[model samples]
Target: MTKHMTRKQLNSRVVDEIDRNLRQAFDDMAQQPVPDRFTDLLAQLKAAEDKKNSGGQQDA
Candidate 1:
């Protein structure tokens, strides 16, 4: 026996598949940890920019 899906049913199936794939992709990404080196570099950049903005202040 052959079963045929209506046009609307086919479209809904496609949309469901797309949504499932996207949710899984996002979940996989959320499980990954950020590298410490990246965070360290960001902190260094912010500090340097802050110092420059403060006219190289060396307040004690």
Candidate 2:
């Protein structure tokens, strides 16, 4: 027996598969940890901002 899908049905299946693949890729990326270099850079930026906010102090 041969089964034929309607045009709409084929489109729906294609959309579903694309959605599943994208979700899986996002989930895999979300599981990864942030790198230490970026963490350090962010911390340094925050410290600079804090110093600037306290008073525009010029470093000697």
Candidate 3:
């Protein structure tokens, strides 16, 4: 950082740095494969919802 930089310039640089770091962190997370536990939980919820829906339709 330059000592002669104006406050606006310094603030802009800080904001840019923060935006870059956040984007990189989120991009890494997005690239990661879904964990087995998360996939299993989603599948269980879907199955439960399907069963509930079928049961409700039968009652009607």
Candidate 4:
């Protein structure tokens, strides 16, 4: 037996499949932990800002 889908039906099915897969991937990523590298980078940024502020105060 052969089944044929019309253009609209085929497009809807493809869209539904893509939406389902994207939702699943987002749910999986939400459970993961934050990495240490990100924290270290934030700390480095804070240190650089503090140094810049101190230098500006000396110049004034």
The numbered model that scores best in lDDT is: 2
Q: How far is candidate 4 from the true structure (C-alpha RMSD, Å)?
A: 4.6
Q: Candidate 4: list runs displaced more than 4 Å.
A: 1-4, 56-60
Q: What tens digits encode model 4's per-residue C-alpha lDDT throughout 1-60?
A: 459998999999999999999999998998788789998999988987898888853442
Decreasing TM-score order of the candidates? 2, 3, 1, 4
Q: Give, for candidate 4, the lowest lDDT window spanning 10 residues.
A: 51-60
**In angstroms, how far off is 48's CA in candidate 3?**
0.5
Predicted model with the maximum TM-score:
2
TM-score of each: 0.65, 0.81, 0.79, 0.59
lDDT per model, in order?
0.93, 0.94, 0.90, 0.87
CA error at residue 60 for candidate 3, angstroms: 20
Residue clash pairs of candidate 4: none
> Which pairs, if any, clash in model 2?
none
Q: Which window of ten consecutive residues has the lowest lDDT sum in model 3?
A: 51-60
Q: For model 4, what is the C-alpha lDDT against the true structure?
A: 0.87
Q: Give the per-residue Cα lDDT of candidate 3 at 1.
A: 71
* C-alpha lDDT of residue 44 in model 1: 90
lDDT of 4 at 51: 86
Across 8-50, the per-residue lDDT of candidate 3 in tens digits comes to 9999999999999999999999999999999999998898789
